[model samples]
Target: MASKVIHAIYTDDDILLQAVKQVRAGRYHIAEIYTPFPVHGLDKAMGLEPTRLAITSFLYGLVGLAVAIVMMNYMMIEDWPQDIGGKPSFSFLSNLPAFVPIIFELTVFFAAHLMVITFYMRSKLWPFKEAENPDVRTTDDHFLMEIDVEDHDVNQLSKFLYDTGALEINLIDNK
Candidate 1:
């Protein structure tokens, strides 16, 4: 089976944003967007829900904190008790102050690394994955908006996008 879509190209982000809003106003469906850089409010304009990556990051940080605390307790207090200066303390609770730096570092490390991995996976950006962008110009200065062609007249949709200031329009067929 083959599916057809319309690709509208815009030279400016502002124009693309406006075109998106107008398309949605007309109750048209936008399949995807490709841009060289992030456009502020584009997601909201596209009617996308807020991301939950921040919540996941906080949970990952908590896991890192727990791992750091347990590792420190086992290594410092139980595994190899060290005696420095005049005091020899072998209790994790009593030596928690000294482990603050390690805990903080581990928490940050886990959160940042795991967040990147989660984003990549969620976006289906696997190693050696083929690119999905229909046009290479979108990676440079152009912005491309993909509009679904379901239950809509192609000529009318292309005409609408042209009126909305699309620099170029293309019909793509996917198998």
Candidate 2:
């Protein structure tokens, strides 16, 4: 079945919560919801699953640290042992301060670049991509909910939306 997109604008958070509660009580299916900023407890009300970005970030950071360690050890110890000013290149255990800059820089480099790549992939937001945002006002001051309902209940859905404190309601047919 095709989807019918609806836009609902709310004045404040309370009205939005009331509308969500009413929809949940009626057992209606909600497709997506957009808000200018996060509404507290909204995820719990919508029954969304926890995000996995944190785990991905941690793993990426660890990989970066491992790469930094191996690269530094190989370059400084085996490949080209530079005896600058008679300073031993065997181990950085004594002159740890000198290695601090490289270690810190590599850690930041890996975490920042890799995490951003992961986030973009996870959100399906690639460079120069256009996403289907139903309403432009949704990014600013409006709260919008896209709901799916039976063909017979299109008018009923509109009426239900208005009664539940929707400032303005509009529908679009998605084939």
* Candidate 2 ranges beyond 4 A from true positions: 84-86, 92-97, 150-152
* Total clashes in model 2, counting residue pairs 3 or more apart in sequence or in different chains: 0
What's the lDDT for candidate 2? 0.80
Residues 67-159, candidate 2, lDDT per residue (tens digit)?
A: 887888788877897987787898857546677788878887888899899888988998899966877887888888877765537788889
Candidate 1 residue 163 C-alpha distance from true site, Å: 1.0
> Which candidate wins on TM-score?
1
Compared with the true structure, what per-residue lDDT tens digits does model 1 show for residues 1-175? 2298899999999999999999999998899999999999899999999999999999999999999999998898888888866445667888888889999999999999999999999999999999987899999999999988988999999999999999999998888
Positional deviation of 147 in candidate 1, in angstroms? 0.4
* Clashes (N, CA, C under 3 Å) per candidate: 0, 0
Error of 1 at 63 (Å): 0.3
**Top model number, lDDT:** 1
